[model samples]
Target: MLHHQAIITDIKAIIAQSQEKAIRTIDHQRTLMYWAIGERIFREEQQGKDRADYGQHLTAYIAQALEPELGSGFSKRQVELMRQFYRTFPIANTLYSQLSWSQYKLLLRLDSHDQRTFYMAETVKNNWTVRQLERQIYTNLYERLLVSNDKESVLAVAQNEQLPSDAKQIIKDPMFLEFLGFRRESAFYEKDLETAIITHLQEFLLELGNGFSFVARQKRIHIEGDDFFVDLVFYNRLLQCFVIIEIKTAKLTHQDLGQLQMYVNYYDRVEKLPHENATIGILLCADKNDAVVRYSLPAGQKQIVASQYKLYLPTEQQLLAELNKELYSFEKGE
Candidate 1:
């Protein structure tokens, strides 16, 4: 019986490892294939001798021929994508298949090469889904970094693969939680939201903005004679620490910050492993006062963050208005 159990365990382990390797190999091959396609398109364009009309005609011709054989992804739009695929990444060998064609298409749309490259690298490293990539890009993450940080440091983090010490600062929060299918301005108990997040934990993690994985929901911690249940706890693999989140339906207060501080301190001093970094706390509130947060937290406070979350996805106009507001505040030295 024991021998059979051992054999089963071994087989399962082998299967798991093989699946992982196969996925990587598939990604690598797909990446290489796109590179080759791009190369072929480039060569054809070069043969047309810098004539834009010839390039379009050739693409149309090729699309007509290939569409019947290759199906939908080979239409004129795809051929254009292939051309862009090569133009965006001149070196075929540099193309990585770990990221899908859609990801490349999004990156190609980005005006800034540095920003695109940064997102590409991070997407590969983090295995960001298409939705996550879209969110980050739409949020103007690159612009935010350029404004908030030193040029050299920000560029290095974006381009040279230098992981920022304060990665939390780069992580946005209250991150468009409308995916939960919750209505904005609806009154609900905090427990209801917590339960929903726990129920749809995977979606919640994606909405939480990067490097987050579920650890516990309403996790109980015993201290002295009393027991406190943390609303949500997650661990960030990239950052190497526990992230404790407190959900608030009301406006954030100094007391809330103080409570979160205690939780963070507890995780840091007692729960965190010796090798792990200090725990970080986030107050996910319906509204936040930047001035209050700044005054409540200590100086050089990198561990705690307060962000407002919306239950519904904002419309384009709403997003634009928010962006204008942010820009206006920044301009006014707020």
Candidate 2:
């Protein structure tokens, strides 16, 4: 009986694997079909550039003839999208097999070539679902990362051209915690925020950036007969260091920085292996004054970072403004 059950399990596994493979094959074929159609449409439009209305008339004619026979995939709007997809990609080799038609549709909406490239590389690297890709795009993950790192460096890291050497490369200054389901107007304690983060740990790690795995919550330490609890402990594989996070429900102060620094010191001296890099301390707070953060930490300090957490995602305008401010600061050598 046990042998029969084992055989059944093996067969189920094989069936599931084949099903997934079939789905992937279908998705890839659909992508190729769309690309081919788009390429043909673009070629036809080029041949009729002399006639301004010819391109419009051609699309309408094709859609009118195909929609009823081929379903709404060939609708006028979708046909336009296909044309745009060809024009945007230009090279057939650039389209990745891992990305589905839905993912491509979302990618088409991005206007910047760099942004599209970054998202493409990230989506493939992380094996992000269409929904995950959409969330990252809407949350302005690219813009947020740009706030700390230069464009070339950011793109290089995303494309796997280089591993991140600095914590700032992977970490964002104002991290979004909208997934925690916290209300913007509501008051919450540090413990409440910490509990929420622990409950929604996976989402927190996604927002925290790449290579992070949860280690502990309220991790206790002892020094000279005194005990203290660190709010959160994480290990980043890429950076090869322990990330010690301290949550602050109020605006950041110099005292908060000091306490986090102490935890970082303890982790480095006690918990960290000699082969690992220095522990990074992140002060996740509700609000922070840049000047306070700067002066609070020693000059040329890289280990401690104070990042603000928002209950809601910022608007495009707000992210743009933040990016601009960071750029200005960088230019001024701040």
Candidate 3:
């Protein structure tokens, strides 16, 4: 009976594999066809540019001619996207096999080659779905990571060429929790904020950067007679340690830093295994007092980090200005 069941399962698996292969083949063919059409259009445009100006209505005319006989898939907008796709990915051989048409469309929406290359490398490395790619772009993942480092290091990190050796390299400041649907103007408790984060845990993890998985929430720890509850606990496989996180809905203070430091020391001494790295404690506050935290911690402290959280995405202009400022500082060795 076991042998027969195993055979049946194998047959089902084979059938599923064949179906996926067929789908992939169809998609590959579709992508090639689109690229070919775009190339043809581009060549024709170049030839006609000096003799006459047919640039504006070329795709429109092509769409009108093709759609009636072929279908709605070759509409004006799609054709234009195809043209852009060819222009952006000029060399067909450089196209990634893992990327689908939908993923390519999202990549093309980005403004710069640097952003496109970073997302392309990340999408393949992480196997990000189209939805995941879109979310990362919307949250400005590139810019967030770019803030703490120079452009070269940022791009290198995105390309997976340089793995971050420290939390400072990976932990983005002023994390955007806008997806949690909290209202900044309204009154809310720390518990309420933690509950919202746990409720939307996956989005929160993505915001936290990669390799982090939830471990516990409101984790109780008893030292002597006193009790403490950590708002969130996560483990990062890449960092090879437990990450303790505490939530504060108000501005951060020296007390919060001291408390988080104590948590880090507790975890390192009591909970951390012999082989694992020391525990990392993060204090998430509504307002980050950077200078105070710097003064509170000893020089070159790596275990505890404090970061600000926002209920809404920060303004792009503000982030860009900060990124430029940071880049300048980095260049000047500040």
Please count the clashing residue pairs in each candidate, in the order shown.
0, 0, 0
Q: List the residue pairs that clash in candidate 3.
A: none
* Model 2, runs deviating above 4 Å: 1-7
Prediction 1 global C-alpha lDDT: 0.78
RMSD of each: 3.5, 1.7, 3.0
Which residue pairs overlap in candidate 2's backbone?
none
Q: Is candidate 2 or candidate 3 better by lDDT?
A: 2
159-237 per-residue lDDT for model 3 (tens digits): 7888766776678876888888976588889999888989999888878976789999988999999999877899988
Off by over 4 Å in 3: 1-25, 314-334
Winner of 1 and 3 under lDDT? 3
Q: Rate the local accuracy (lDDT) of all candidates.
A: 0.78, 0.90, 0.84
The lowest-lDDT stretch of 10 consecutive residues in candidate 1 is 142-151
Put down candidate 2 lDDT per residue, 13-49, tens digits, no spaces.
9999999889988998998888899899888888885
- Candidate 2 residue 70 C-alpha distance from true site, Å: 1.7
- The sequence of per-residue lDDT tens digits that candidate 1 reaches over residues 63-175 is 89999999987899888888887788888667766777677888988877788777886687667888888877776655555434554566666444566677444555445
TM-score (C-alpha, index-matched) for candidate 1: 0.81
Over 4 Å off, model 1: 5-31, 47-50, 131-160, 209-213, 220-227, 268-276, 324-333
Q: Tell me which of candidates 1 and 3 scores higher on TM-score.
A: 3
TM-score of each: 0.81, 0.95, 0.87
Model 2 poorest 10 in a row by lDDT: 49-58
